[model samples]
Target: MRPMLNIAIRIIRNIGNIIIKNYEIQNINSDYNEYNINLFTKKINKNLNNMITKVIYNIYTKNITFLCKKKFFIFKYKKTIWIINPLDGVMNFFKKLPHFSISIAICIKGKTEISLVYDPLKNDLFTAIRGQNAQLNGYKLRCDKYFQKKNLLFALNTSYIFFTKKKNVNLINLFVENLISLRISGSISLDLAYLAANKIDCYLNNNVQNFNYLLAGELIIKESGGLITDFIGNCNYKNSTNILAGNADIIKLVISKIK
Candidate 1:
């Protein structure tokens, strides 16, 4: 396959088409010029998050693979894979419900290195580097801890957990009780990006794709002054059945409870 990145671009184009065809077409918001690019050579950074699915990309490889998630596209690259969930909340968008997005990231050598998540409906993008800052559109972003709710928003993949053995139910409920609010967004990539943006306090994944598929947001949270690790508190992001990510304080507390 051409490589994950290339597939991501094609997927973005497809999503953009869907959005423009579905909603009123408009010009690109003049918010961030430095973050604008429709090519793969463009600098990959946090600011690229907003234009999540309108980009046309090429990943320098032979053969290409594409997969669609509800209304998104995922691709495969050489020694890497690109997964893009375009239109994360399609149901909400079709119903004029609320926030929806397009998420794209690349996993290289089993680690997340590049990510570009955009909300096509809002034309907002969030980009990130492995060890650098994350940006919203073009402005640097840091996950703020000003949330005062005693039960800060907690996100989980409940649908995926329903099939789990009953033995894990206690652990699930224990985690649930710690948060002030809980949500089940159907998009995993968006869930992690939301954490980087401080929209949510913590997120846990029970059974997701390979670790490489998660590195982009994993590194984003770390770069944005957050924390990430498996159930055992190990920082390894390469191979794990589950992951806990959030701000440093939240991750520590959540990890302590899991132990």
Candidate 2:
């Protein structure tokens, strides 16, 4: 586990350097090289997948399956499954918003065993192992259980607004009106990570199509004493599941407002 952590740190640091350097260049030629950001992201994604494959192979002799954005590689034995999101917030990356991250999780028979999410710009690494407390950097983290409407901060991902029903939008608006504030960050992984660290008290996502997006943060929040469930408060992971994550009391507050 230590070796894996070391490798992950190294990988993210290298990738962060690449992104920062490219972003500097993009700023100088923003008008002319708008499309270059996409190319840069593609290069980074390719390098990340290749590097992870080599690193994992060297660490374990057992067959492993690797899943990432638009690419899935399967090795024969499948004792472990590695799920990764090399660049989580590509849109933010292209916009040079500094809100993107790298997410990685190891699952055994569909249950996550280890999870990691790295924010390159902030150098924040959130990690959790099943049955162990979640950590930011090296310090243990736990969610805040207090549910105060006057002081609560809710992180929301409103990307699903186009597809969401009117009732759902009304429910979201209810939260907006009642909570102290509502934040919409484009990165779902970071939103969940922030929730686990108590930087935000709650997170709601209506369009999490892939488990890869939430897998790492899910474990982190859970190990940090946060509760995550579908819109109706069921602990099921599926493509259609709308994510609601926070401490137990906040989760109940969110569930109660869903119409």
Best by lDDT: 2
Overlapping backbone residue pairs in candidate 1 total 25
Tell me how far the alpha carbon of residue 160 in candidate 1 is from the true structure, in angstroms, after superposition: 6.7
C-alpha-based local distance difference test score of model 1: 0.61
Per-residue CA lDDT of candidate 1, range 15-72, in tens? 5556545544323333323233222112221223334423423334345555544333
TM-score of 1: 0.65
Candidate topping TM-score: 2
Which residue pairs in model 2 clash with each other?
none
Model 2: per-residue Cα lDDT at residue 23: 58
Model 2: weakest 10-residue lDDT segment is 68-77
lDDT of each: 0.61, 0.75
Estimate, for each residue in 50-127, the C-alpha lDDT of model 2 and write its tens digit. Answer: 766776677676645444437332332355666767667777777778788877777777788888888888889999
Q: TM-scores of all models?
A: 0.65, 0.86
